[model samples]
Target: MASFQIIIIGTGIAGLATAISLSQKTQHQILILESSSVLTEAGAGIQCSAAASRVLSSWALREEFEAVATCPDFTEIRRYEDDELIGLIPANVNDYSTRLRGFPHWLVHRVDYQKILADAATTRGVKIDFGQKVVAIDVDNVEVTLASGRSLRADLIIGADGIHSRTRRSIPALKDVVPRRTENYCYRALIPREEMLKNPVTATLIDNQSQQAWAGQFKHIISYPIAKGKFYNLVMTVPDHGDAPLGQYNEPGDVSEMRQVFKDFNETVQAVLDTIDSCAKWVLADLPPLPTWSSPNGRVILVGDACHAMAPHAASGAATSLEDAEVLGLCIATCNGIADLPRAAKDYEHLRRPRCERIQEISRENATTFALPDGPMQEARDQIWRAQKAMLEKQLQEDTPLAIPAEDMAQQFPHPALVQWLVGHDIIEEARTHLATRKEIHNIL
Candidate 1:
């Protein structure tokens, strides 16, 4: 029998989710390597959309999230100038029972989510090794060389490293791929729930279970409850085209500048801004949709930001990565621990490239609309978003920006239902037909 061990680089949600999803399906051994001497995560919060929650709920994390996560009862998008509630995003039964169980978003601490994912992976028999940096991946032999000079040979290698993934750049096939920085800077702050509740402007049920997203001419801010209602997390987006590589938090940010970013706004927003502590700025960056993330050889491939990275427009980056994990796992489940590995990698890219590319486009488009200048475009967009709210609430088919034929979209994500089906049903014939004209591009020698 061929060896069936899988090696994963990184320990974030993407890495753990892959190990967990694949552990139950095959007898394959799984190893996850993280570079940190100890766990170190960004000081921020992550919002799990309905689609993302759907994947997690199926993984049986629904109750755990409910216990520690602050469920948002409503999602409100408002205008920056006057703070008029643009429209409300409703959380209904289908969204609830299958995904978040009724909440559109969950305000979760980064550390909390990481712990839960790590624990889940361990329970599934995944061997996790910390403090090992993956310096090189020999796709030809399915081996990985760590920074410490340890050699690891596996049936497959998954690079879940972040935006500046060393494994991605190491692959000659992905040599020309470049990550693009969006013309936006994200600033975040965390405050005690009691402090926010004490502010008269946000004192009202703002302390309750709900999320607030406000759009302005050139900036945006998101605030929601977190830490089991003990603290609140806020992230504000401001326009900045300056040169910065995801700047670190060291020098303090001017409070005036932070306030001015949303000065023409609501009293509640103004009040919240007054409480921000400095040293916050993340230059948003994303990779263009690649036709393939697989390597020139079949034994190695990229996952998470190492592959189809998207802007945090819909908070879909991690969600999509987890999806990629599941599908990749399914492909490897067929591995007989032999030379069948090449065929498995080819099939994996064939099934994934189209979908990840589609999601990449959707995520980019969302960024454009969200940052639309204040003018006719904004007016038209407001109308469209309101309609989306209605459709999502009334069970009507959402009217898309353009009428794309179902066949065309089939190359990637054809519909929201497909996302759910990716976790459930997939007809093999459709996949075979789709990749019919496709050759083994990733493994093309």
Candidate 2:
């Protein structure tokens, strides 16, 4: 293997994770560019399923992550109007060894998780330059021009910039790839655990350390505890009626308006909303599946939200980004020199694109299923949930595994098989297998 210069744009989860993973797998000189002068404390809570958690564990971040993250015991789904229990999924149970791939499902604050990755990457000899916004990308020359008119050349460039990626726009081949607004907006707020505990209705949530979701007509709410359970994170997604401006992705939300939208929700949800002093409204948008994730020469490539930004309905945005970082690193490690960079980039895209595209589709489907109005379809969905709940309860009481028909399982929200496939996937092993097969083919040829 030969050493090369690698530049990763942005310092979000994808950028930082790529830096760390590449540092561990390859001998390349890695640099991360951040547009912000300082690491801003933005974003709300994020879920880290076993798929991403396994990658973090490989990077030796488990202890630090566990210290700041909350492992919810289970997840509960309920009706919006009367708080009728619809379904229950065990998230972090001892007996259910296969749950979450035997790794704890982490509910963590985004800021804390990013800091951990940043620190780990720095410790591994990766350098991050702040306030170095990428203004343009020269795919042919394998270089980037910063906003300050500084040109930096590298052997390869990874565009982890984000949804409004300048790097993606710089590539002529990706001109057709654009983000489309989903007409869905989310109001995010955090309530203090102490405040919640003061109210008995909300105290149960804090005590259980469980994730809760309320499904309603054209809207839904999901809440979980983060920051070591000291703060509770709330996300309310509803139809977007020009709440935020076209260009603005995130802005201050009106508390009164947020409360009114979910005012008809059950008492517990209302209590949670009432505890919020302020909230931020964010517009939901997603990109169509791109024809390619790399330039013609493959010196430049996209990762994370830069190429595959999806609706947050599935709560797998960050996890998928982490998977991208891991898979990219593993693929790049197979390259012997600069000439092999193109093949490595192609392999990264081949392994990642289908999975990401499928997840994107699932996220969009969830947005509809989670907010069904009172209708026959809504009733049918609720009936599936009720059946699933009964089956889960029966399994607990009988202490035995009951064979569930694949079709029956498919009907449940969050689809058990889908959850397992999402969280239990070993990206590392798959990358290794892919590389091994490619090597054998090359030898035979």
Candidate 3:
């Protein structure tokens, strides 16, 4: 009998979710490797849309997630120059249990979410090894060599490393694939909740429990509350003027430099900026859609950002990875032994590629729209948002049949649709159906 041993690279959301989901269906010894001496995630916020929530909830993480995440009631968009309200997209979770089958939209800190996933995975018997950098991989043989020259073998190897994944290069068939800089650098900051609440200017902003985005010439900023309102997460994306291959992904940034970038922004935005003491900076990079994410033997495969590194505009970067983890985990569950893994891996690629690629394209488009300069095109985009906002308010008034005042209309606008294509997808059920058909075909053969 083949050994049901699995080795996963990285300890991020993708790796942990994969281990947890796979352990649910079968008893397998899973090992996760991390290169860092200490496990830490960047200080930033991540939005978990309804679709991702469904996947996590299925894993029995709903209660834990709700404890640390804030379910925003609405997300507002404004012009950076004058703070003109252009759109107010209400959360689809407004009716909680009715829409998306009770799935929620969550805003959480990256570090907190990582800990939750890691804790869940460990409770299921998944072993995690820190300070172990994988230096080489034999895809066909399902073997990995660490920097220390120690060799380990498994029935399967999953590459869950991020955009600059070394595991991605280990596939012998891929030689030209590399992460390309998008010329966009992201600056991140975390504001202490107590200090923010103490200031009258910042207190009202966070009191409403909403996610806000401000768009400007060639840049944008998104801010929201995480850790049950313990901290405010802020991310600002601007065009990078520095040379490529900075030799590192993250660097220290000064608060004064960041403030100057948005010096012309509205008073509210400026007020929030003054509170930031320091920021972390990183250039956003993504890889082109690879022809395949599996090795020739199919015993080794790539998941998450390792294969579909996308711009963060669509807010689907981590969510898509969760979808991948859920589906790939289900597909692997169909494997009766190591011999069946190749077919399962092939099926995973077949089902995942199209969906992930579409999201990748959408992310780029969203980024382009969000970063448009002050021009006719930007004006047109703003006009569309205004029209949608008006229509949504009208619908809200009609549905409620109440004489709402104009001042209250801002809070009464009907919820707008999120990326409809991604919001309600049932990836788990789809994977199960795919596996059922595969079994049928095998029986007939």
Error of 2 at 441 (Å): 8.7
**What tens-digit string does per-residue lDDT give for candidate 2 at 133-234?**
899999999999998999999999999999889899878889667788886889999888889898999888877678998999999998899988788898
Cα displacement (angstroms), candidate 2, residue 16, comes to 0.4
Better of 2 and 3 by TM-score: 2
User: Model 1 over residues 1-445: C-alpha lDDT tens digits?
Assistant: 5547789898887888888877866777899999987666676678776556656666788787767787776667888777787755543323432342222456688888888888888998999999998888887777889999989898778888877777787677676888887777777777776777777776653566777778777667777877777767777777767755562432346667777767777877888777665536677778886656766666677888788777666666777776767666666666555566667677777777776676667666656666678899889878866775665556524423322122333332213343333322332333444444455322221
**Candidate lDDT (C-alpha), each:** 0.68, 0.84, 0.80
Clashing pairs in 2: none
What does candidate 3's lDDT look like per residue over 310-402, in tens digits?
988778888988888988888777776777777888889988998888777766666677778998998988888889778767766565532
Candidate 2 local Cα displacement, residue 4, angstroms: 0.9
Candidate 3, poorest ten consecutive residues by summed lDDT: 404-413
- lDDT preference between candidates 2 and 3, better one: 2
Give the CA lDDT, 0 to 100, for residue 427 in model 2: 73
TM-score of 1: 0.84
- TM-score for all predictions? 0.84, 0.95, 0.92
Which numbered prediction scores highest in lDDT against the true structure? 2
